[model samples]
Target: MIIGVVLLLVFFLVNISIGSVYIPIPQLIHGLLGADLDKASWETILFLYRIPKAITAVLVGISLSVSGLQMQTFFRNPLAGPYVLGISSGAGLGVAIMIMGGSALGITFSSSSNYMTWGIWGIIISGSLGAILVLLLMSLTAWKIKDSMTLLIIGLMFGSASGAVVSVLSYFGNAEDLKLFTIWSMGSLGGISGTQLEILSIICFIGIIPVIALLKSYNAMLMGERYATSMGVNIKSLRWAMILSTGLLAGSATAFCGPIAFIGIAVPHLARMIFRTGDHRILFPASALIGSCFLLISDAISQIPGSAETLPINVITSLFGAPLVIWLILKRNLSSEF
Candidate 1:
């Protein structure tokens, strides 16, 4: 745990310091302390852009990783995740509606108008509602069905349905609106403003409470539903709590940073490999720290280090995570650790 935390901090500082224009440690400290620097641009870049982006990377990492851990524990399926379960697709649908649907109806949503202040809230609320809606449906299905594999199939169906709807909306949308949604879907950590970062932080914090509270329940559920029920775990209530927590975490990340892929699925397994345990008490914090570090590293790489041009965050993460997913599938041993 201590090692994970230390790495997370180190990478976070590296993320903040090693942008296009590298700021040395002494100058970085001076700028952070509000001391006048040789270049005013250094202070502006450090304070206004890099800091918030780094913070966003941290929150995104922690939220997605922890949420993935919860899903893997609750569903007891190696392939299950926010994207697989349709939560991200649902959030993407909400964003599509807000951007494409609103534009179709002659409504303007941008940072230039008076509605600018409320725009982020609108996206976040719509995304959360969309994710919760899918989660509730999945919960209902889980209640009626006793098979985890069945629930996994149902979740994939939901993702497909939502994706179709989004595609239709995109077809009817204007070129400019399509471009905006396209950029958002690519997933950029650098796009979050200071105000949006505050909102994302608060939502992620609230989302994590339910995760922390259910650590014991998660450990119980790991042994299978029958065993968990034998141990007096309220399986139904636990399902609701997890779905709600995941909705807030995954949905808010999608709303602010677009639908990030693979981290939610890959990070828990990475944590397990690092920690060498199945205990939720240990896995939770380990996943959070490792997830943050991984995303920070991805963010740093995406910046192209020393270049003004940058790659999309999703591209970097997918490059790292996609092969792991393939390996897991080929190995067919997702349940080995559990």
Candidate 2:
């Protein structure tokens, strides 16, 4: 835990320091301390932009990673994740409807009074509703399907169906709206402002409460449903909590940052490898810390340090996560560990 915390802080500082304009360590410290900087622009870049972006990266890392852990535990499938289970896609679909459908309906989101406030909340609520809807559908199926692999297949089908809907919406949408949705799908960590950051933080906080409360249930469930049931765990309620927590975390992250891939699927495994334990108590915090560090590093890399150009956040995560998924498949070690 201590090591993870140290790495997280180190990566965070690096993420903030190495953006477009490299701020020297001394200047960065001065800006953080509220001291006058040699250049006013340095302060603006550090406080107004880089700091918030770094914080968003941290929150996203923790949210997706922890949510991934919950999903894997709940379904007992190594490949189960927010993205894999269609939660992220569902959220993306909702955002698409709001952006594309709103235009079709002649509803302008950005021109109205309190547009920023309404716009952010609108996306969040829409994303949450979409995620919850998919989760509920999967929950209902989970009752009849005893096999985890079948449920995994169903989740993938859900993702595909949602993606198809999004494509149809985009095809008939306005050019400007299509462009906006395209850029959003590309994923971004730097787009969030301080206000959006606060809202994201609160939603994540609400989602995490259930995760923390259900740690015991998660540990018991790992032993198998029969054992968990014998121990008096309420299987039904546990599933609901898992779905709710995963939806809030994954939905909020997608709503604000777009459909970020790989982090949700990869981070839990990274945590398991690092801690070499299946205990949720250890894995939970470990995943959060390691996930944050992984994302901070990805954010720094996406900046293409010393260059003006930046790559999409999803691109970097996919490059890192896809190979990990393949390795897990080839090794055939999905349910063996947890």
| Candidate 1 residue runs with Cα over 4 Å from true position | 107-125, 135-151, 324-335
Superposed by TM-score, candidate 1 places the C-alpha of residue 64 at a distance from the truth, in angstroms, of 0.5
For candidate 1, list the clashing residue pairs, or say none.
none
Name the weakest run of 10 consecutive residues (lDDT summed) in model 2. 108-117
lDDT of 1 at 120: 58
For residues 1-338, write the lDDT of model 1, one tens digit per residue: 88777888789788898878988877777777779978889888988899999999999998899989998888887667767678889888988888788877887553257247655577667777777788778778878976766777888899999999999999998887788778778898885777788989999999999888989989999898889999999887887787778878988888778888779988898777667799999999998998889889999998888898888899999997788656864665556775
Superposition-based RMSD of candidate 2 using all C-alpha atoms, in angstroms:
3.3
Candidate of highest TM-score: 1
Which runs in model 2 stand beyond 4 Å of their true positions?
A: 106-125, 132-157, 324-338
Per-model TM-score on C-alpha atoms: 0.89, 0.87
lDDT of each: 0.83, 0.83
